[model samples]
Target: MSEKLRDQLVGAWKLHSYVEIPVDGSEPFYPMGEKPMGIIMYTPDGYMSAQLMKPGRAPFAVNDFYEGTLEEYKAAGSTYIAYTGPFKVNEQNRTLTHSMFISLFPNWMGQTQPRVVSIEGDVLTLGTASPISSKGKTVNSKLVWHRAQPE
Candidate 1:
């Protein structure tokens, strides 16, 4: 059954869409614009890393990573999401947990977050298990991914 499956996820996935649905009756918000770009990879040895970003982000005036101006830094920071660490799958419950040891979002650092997983065809959808605070509003995040094809 799908719930008792995990091997299907051991590969690279490319982001298709990301939407944050607010519980307060407001319209859904796109954290990285309508068409975001990202990649998520789950290694065979229980490790995973995800990096997402708004497409067409402007390059900083300075080429250095740590030398960008305040505005540049803020723009880059707000437009991207990233995290990496160990991952565990609960085949019985049909859920996956991402233990964030390195996260761009401060609140997620050293945290383990659960995702409700659904894979249909070549698409994989992972969603937050519960509503979480984001930009001062309660929202649930849903991120869709497509299995990356071998080059």
Candidate 2:
């Protein structure tokens, strides 16, 4: 990992936006809601983990399947997901791969996802390409992160 990337990612980040685009080039917005939150912390020991939260209220709006309507799932309050695993930066590929040993994202369980990240000052944009292309189209999810302020 380049020192540059390390310096930019060492701290924590807060979620700003989350969007899932369909293979048909249609835009579907997913809500992190008013208090959607996330935290990414990188350690000097080369360990990394991230946690993301979505405000609990209505269905995801886009995919009704992810709507955890069960009383238990709803009483769970705001839905929170997290992953703790190994991470690597391939400067040559301009990508970062996170091999999540643990993930709450059902689809991401035991999956390693490579995310392309762009950083500018305190803003970071994170996204990944879709594996299943449809009609020569592609889908992707993008989430914006803002660097946390130092206490």
Strongest candidate by TM-score: 1
lDDT of 1 by residue, 58-79 (tens): 9999889989999999999999
Return the top candidate by lDDT.
1
Off by over 4 Å in 2: 1-3, 56-70, 74-78, 131-138
The whole-model lDDT of each prediction reads 0.91, 0.70
Q: Give the per-residue lDDT of model 2 (tens digit) for 45-120.
A: 5667888877654444346556655764654433666888887777666677778887775667778888878888
- Clashing pairs for predicted structure model 2, backbone only: none
Consecutive 10-residue window with the lowest summed lDDT within model 2: 129-138
Model 2 clash count equals: 0
CA deviation > 4 Å runs, candidate 1: 1-4
TM-score of each: 0.94, 0.73
